[model samples]
Target: MRYNIIHRTTYKYESPVTVGHYMARLEPRTLPFQECPWHELTIFPSPIERAERSDYFGNTNVYFEIEGSHQKLEVIARSLVEVIRAQPFDPASTPPWETIRDSCRSDVYNPATPAGELTFASTLIPVGVPYADYARPSFLPGRPILQGVCDLNRRIHRDFVFDPKATDAATPVEKVLKQRRGVCQDFAQVMIACLRSLGLPARYVSGYLETVPPPGVVKLVGADASHAWVSVYCGEVCGWMDADPTNDVLPSERHITVAWGRDFADVSPLRGVTTGAGEQRLKVAVDVLPDKD
Candidate 1:
C-alpha cells in the first residue's frame, strides 16, 4: 500500500518577540516492510538555520531555528511512503514469556542493544507490580511471548474507552489504567508499562494509522491523526513485532511507522523552545490518504 501523508502543526502565541528552536521527527521510516521515497519539511517564517540527522533510534530528525519573531508559527511535513504487509507467524510458536523476560532482565543495563534498552522504565512509563499484575492473566506459565502480548492488546481494547478529553500527552499510565480511558498514546504507554514491569522488552512506536470514512460519506481531509503503538521483542529468531492495543490488531500495511523509542518523549512529532512566546494555542491536522498512481 502507498500513502501520501501531510502533517501540519500551527502555534499561535499571544506575544512573540525573539527566537525559536525546534526539532521534528515527522519523516516516515524505511524498514524491511516499509519505504519512504520522498519527504519534506516546510516551515513558515522560514528558519534561519536548518539541518537533518538520525537519532539514536535511527529515526530521521530535523532541527531548525528561527531568529526573528512572529506570533504564528507553522510547520508542515509531507511524505510519500510504501508499506508491505509483514509475514504472518504463529504467536504460539515463539519463546515463552518467562524466557524472554529472564534473558532481558539479566543484561538490561546494556543499552547498546535495542531490546535491552527498552526493558526498563522510561520517563513516561513506569514499571511496577500493578502493571505486572494487570498483565499476569495473559502471560501464564510457559505462554508464548507474542501470544501473551496479543491477549494483552485485545484486553486493553476491550477494557478502555477512547476518550480524547480524558487525557493528554502528559497523562500518566497509572492514571489511565485507573480511568480506563484515553487516546492511543495512553493505551500504548500502558501496554509498554505492563510489559516492562514484567521484565519484557517493549518499545513505543509513533506513526500514522489510516482512517477510512463510511462507505457513502466523503473522507475529510484532516480527519486522520497521529497514532502510537507497542512493539515487543520475542527473542532473536522472531525478532520485534508490533501490536496496536488501540485497535486490537498487529500493525500492517496501513500503519506507517515514523519513529520509535522507550516512550513518546523520544519521538514527539514536533517539540521546541520558544523565547518570549506566552499563552500559545496549538492546532494539528493530519491527513493519511491513499496514493494514486
Candidate 2:
C-alpha cells in the first residue's frame, strides 16, 4: 500500500516568543517492509539555522531555530511512503517467553546483542512489582513469547478505556494504570513498562493510523491523528513485533511508522524550548490517505 501523509502543527502563543530552538521527528521510516521516497518540511517565520541527523534508534531528526519574535508558529510536514505487509510469524514456533527474556541479560552487550539495551527501565517507563503482576497472568510457563504478549495486549484493550481527556502527556503511568483510561501513548507506555518489568525488551512506537469512517461516510479532513504502539523483541528470528493494545491488533499495513525509542519523550514528533513566551495553545492535524493509482 502507498500513502500520502500530511501532518501540521500550530502553536498560538498569547505572548510572542523572541528565540526558540525546535526538533522534529516527523519523517516516515524506510524499513525492509516500507519505503519513503519523498519528504518535505515547511516552518513559518523561517528558521535562522536548520540541520538534519539521525537519533540513536535511527529515526530522522530535524532541528531548526527561530531568532526573531513571533506570536504564532506553524509547521507542515509532508511525505510519500509505500508499505507492504510482511509475512506473519507463527507464534507457536517462537521460543518460550522466559527464554527470550533471559537472553537480554547476557554479560556482553553490543549491536549484535539480543536487545539488552531495551530490557531495562527508562525515564518514562518504570518497571515495578505492579507492572510484573499485571502482566504475569498472560505469560504462563512455557508459553510462546508472541502468544503471551498478545494475550497481555488483549487484556489491556479489554480492561482499559480510550478516554482522550483522562490523561495528558505528562501524566504518570501509575495514574493511567489506576484510572484505566487514556490515549494510545498511555497504553503503549503501560505495555512497555509491563514488558520491561518482566525482563523483556519493548519499545515505544509513534506513527499514524488510517481511520476508516463508517460505510458510505466520507472521511473528514484532518480527522486522523498521531498514534502510538509497542514493539517487543521475541528472540532472534522473530525480531521486533508491533502490537497496538489500544486497538488490540498487531500493526501492519495500516500503520505508518514514524519513529521509535525507549518512550514517548524520546520520539515525540515536535518538542523544544522557547524563550519569552507565556500561555500557548497547540493544535495538530494529520491525514493519512491511500494513494490512488
Candidate 3:
C-alpha cells in the first residue's frame, strides 16, 4: 500500500520575540516492513540556521534555530511511502513465556540495529499485576509473570488501552497503571519500564497507522494521526518482534515507521524551547491519504 501524509503543526503565541531552537523527527525511515520512496519537510518563515544528524539511536534528527519576533509559526511535513509487510500466523512455534524471559537478559545487544544497543534490561517489558500472585498467561499455573514484558506480541495487545488523554508525556508508569488509561506512548513506556525492571531491554517506536474505514464509508482527512508502539528482543531466533499495545495487534502493512528510541522523548515529531513568551497555544492537523492513481 502507498500513502501520502501531510502533517501541519501551528503555534500561535500570545506574545513572541527573541530566539528559539527546535528538534524535529518527522522523517520516516525505510525498514524491513516499509519503503519510503519520497519524503520532505517544509517550515514556514524559514529558520536562520539548520543542521541534520543521526542520533545515537539511529533516528534522523533535524535541529534548527529561528531568531526573530513573530507571533505565529507553522511547520509542515509531507511524505509518500510504499509499505509492504507480512503476517505470520503460526503460534505453536512461538517460544514459551519462560524461554522468552530467559533469552532476554541485561547483557544482550544488537550493534547492527539502528539503536546500536540491545540487551535484556533494555528489552524486558513491564507489566502491572493488580495482585502480585495472580496467574499470568505465559507463566506457570501458580507463578506470576512480570508486569510489562509479555512472551508473545499478542499478549501485549490484549492487555492495554488506547486512550489519547489517559496520560501525558510526563505521566509515570505507576500512575498510568493505576488509572488504566493512556495513549500508545504510555503503554509502550509501561512495557519498557517493566522489561527494564526485570533486567531486560526495550525500545519505543513512532510511526503512522493506515486506517481503513468500513465499506462505503468515506475516509476523513486528518482523522488518522501518527501512532506509537514498542519492540522487545526474544533471542536470535525470534529476534525483535514489534507489538502495538494500543491496538492489541502485531504490526502489519497498516503500520509505518518514522523513528525510534529509548522513549518518546527521544523521538518526538517536534520539540523545542523558546525564551520570552508569557503563554502559548498549539494546534495540530494530520492527514494520511492514499496516493492518487
Against the true structure, what is each candidate's TM-score? 0.97, 0.98, 0.82
**Residues 25-135, model 3: lDDT tens digits:** 988887776777887878866999999999987788889888998877788988888888766534445445455455453256443242224332232233444312222
lDDT of 1: 0.92
lDDT (Cα, tens digit) per residue for candidate 2, span 1-293: 99999999999988989999999999999999899999999999899999999989999999999989899999999999999979879888888999887777766663326487898889998999999999999999999999998999999999999999999999999899899999999999999999999998999999999999999999999999999999999877878999999999998899999999999989999998999789999999999999997
Off by over 4 Å in 3: 94-136, 139-161
Candidate 3: residue 87 lDDT (0-100) = 65
Candidate 1 backbone overlaps, count? 0
> What digit string (tens of lDDT, one per residue) describes model 1 on residues 103-187?
7667555332557768889999999999999999999999999999999999999999999999988899999999999999999
TM accuracy, model 2: 0.98
Q: What is the C-alpha lDDT of each candidate?
A: 0.92, 0.93, 0.68
Q: Hey, what RMSD does candidate 3 come out at?
A: 4.3
Alpha-carbon deviation at 172 in model 3, angstroms: 1.3
